[model samples]
Target: MNDIFSVLPDLGNFLVGYVTLTGVCSLRLFMVMFIFPPTADGLLQGVVRNAIVVLFSSYIAYGQPIAFIQTLRGITLIEVGLREALIGVALGYAASIVFWVAEGAGTYIDDLTGYNNVQVMNPSRSEQATPTATLLMQIASVAFWALGGMTFLLGTLYESYHWWPLTSSGPSMSNVLESFVLQQTDSLMQTIAKLAAPMMFILLLIDFGFGFASKSASKLDLMTLSQPVKGAVTVLMLALFVGVFVDQVKEQITLSGLTAEMRALSGGHQGKPD
Candidate 1:
């Protein structure tokens, strides 16, 4: 009884130490997972999601050869956790941009095809989105997993510590934020344009043709007729173009560029990106 009682304090201390270490380590991870694929939407609610975060972050803390700061409690812990959270959110936002292109492309198509009025619950985005927009986003997410995107993302997170290790006073990624946001914006527009422009052009031509017919034969119900025609054509075009969209998505979520950025961050290379 004496031996068991004496060991209780030491065991409690050890558990506290592990929690502190993993808690700081998990900050960034929590931020990242909170945003993307497993916003754990729909069935994954509240405490369940948090438990998973704790579990995965615990795994991350143990799996990686992480370096710990000397005094990990009090305000220092809060600061470190905040820093990690910020970095994780930035990286998560960056990583999710590819999927946004997929979702955006669909939303654009829906807008062009007059389908944007209908909104449905999008589990992936964890918000109400148009049908086509939700479909495309879901497809892209599937492709993300099928093509090993999840692994790559987690790998980047794992390696990020090396770039801006928790103990490091300066989060070196701060300098690249502006340039990185610019890059993300440029990429988002270009990719969304590339994917949606073709469909938009087709929809515009259909609109023009219907408009011309209605103007010439002012008696006809082309306004009502236009809706059905556009809907069918939109379905057909989506089916035909979806394959191309998926193929492009295969390349978009490669995430190699993200890894490159992490490497650059670790190498102390911070400036306007090429």
Candidate 2:
């Protein structure tokens, strides 16, 4: 009982740190989901799924008797607490950036593909998006989670403790804000380009085919045919690219270690990446 009393303070601190870290992650997940088109029903499903993934993994990855012993030997509970909270925020931010990149790419593709004018209500941003753009994001989010992205995320989160120790107060608001914008800009453009590549290529073929059709039928109502033709092409391209987009996002997130890296940075670590 006496020993239990002595250790209670440290244990409590660890729990606080763990919960704060995971809470930050949940918000980040929410943000990523925010830019995608989900019905209210879909959004609730996403939230619940994310909660299960986060809480279950947190216990498994961060909760261990040996880990508690390690905390006693000079690992200040405050430091551990701070680190967990900061890391959770960082991971969440990273996830947000990756999804945003996919969405940004979808936006760019819709612009170039002539689908930009067909705006629909977007639940994610509470604005509007071209059908093509919205469909792509929806597909990407589903694919990201289905392909063990969450498991990989958990592993990376665990790895973070070794690579990014929490010795600082985390990044300042200015720094985090700047990094978030800058990283989003860079990754968003790049991901969009990649996501759009296949569609863009198909569109070029489409343009040539349309031109040939017009040349062959010079007297036909070319303007009337253009809309149907373009619309058909858009639908087909979406079907083909949806799966590809998901795979690409999953690959990028896994390869870049962007989530782990970003979380470290967000938590105010000076040496962490941008």
Candidate 3:
């Protein structure tokens, strides 16, 4: 009885310390998983997903000393949690931009192909998307996995703790984040333009040819012919150029770029020694 009682206090303390540390470490991971793909589609409830992230993060963060709350009451805990979440969100946002660009390119192609009206709910994103858009998104997801992007992302997540420790004061990184976001947005537009350029040019040529044909034959209805003709040409062109498109996507979506972006968002500082 005496031995068990003596160990009980230590056990309780360990559990409390573990939970506290895990909660702190999990904040960033939870936010990243919440926003990033293959995990964000509401397939898992937020509470459940958060718990899984917490467990995973806790394992990764093991052996780190716990930073106990100075007070049980007040906003310090909330502030800390929010700050960690913000860091994760920043990283996830950068990662998601590649998918957004892919989808945008697909949407542009769909418009040119007269498939804009054939919209369906994208289960992955839970948004209305053209068939081509959804297909491209899936291709991006597959390529992301095949390229070892997830491993890179998880490694980056682990490194983030070294860069921005749980107990440290939040660094001023809003300006950095803003600048990165603006640069990424500009890059996204350029990427989409490049992806869709060849297809768009072909579609334009098709349109010009159809218009000339319509003018040459007054009674011929060009509207019906134009839609199907463009659709067929788009499908054929896409099949022929998919290799080029995927190669471009792979070039743009690099792990080094993502890691650099996340480091910038975290203010490029290493954690202080405990």
Can you give the TM-score per candidate against the true fold? 0.85, 0.58, 0.86
Model 2 stretches with alpha carbons more than 4 Å out: 1-42, 45-90, 121-128, 165-181, 201-221, 253-256, 259-274
Candidate 3, 98-212: lDDT as tens digits = 7877789899989887889999887776778998888787777777777877777787887777678766664665776678779878988998898788889989998898899
* Candidate 3 Cα RMSD after full superposition onto the native fold (Å): 2.9
If the candidates were sorted by their TM-score against the true structure, best first, what order would they fall in? 3, 1, 2
Tens-digit per-residue lDDT, 1-274, candidate 2:
9999999999998777566555433442334333323312345465676765566555543544444434433336545454455445555555655566666766766775677788987555556777766666566556655666656665665555445533324446456667766876686677667766776777667677777887898888564565567678877767776666556556754434754555555463544421
Q: What is the lDDT of candidate 2?
A: 0.57
Candidate 3 Cα outliers beyond 4 Å, as residue runs: 2-10, 42-52, 67-73, 251-256, 265-267, 271-274
Model 1 misses residue 77 by how many Å? 0.9
Q: After superposition, how far is residue 220 of candidate 2 from its true place, in Å?
A: 5.5
TM-score for model 1? 0.85
For model 3, what is the C-alpha lDDT against the true structure? 0.75
Residue 182 in model 2: lDDT? 82
Question: Candidate 3: TM-score?
Answer: 0.86
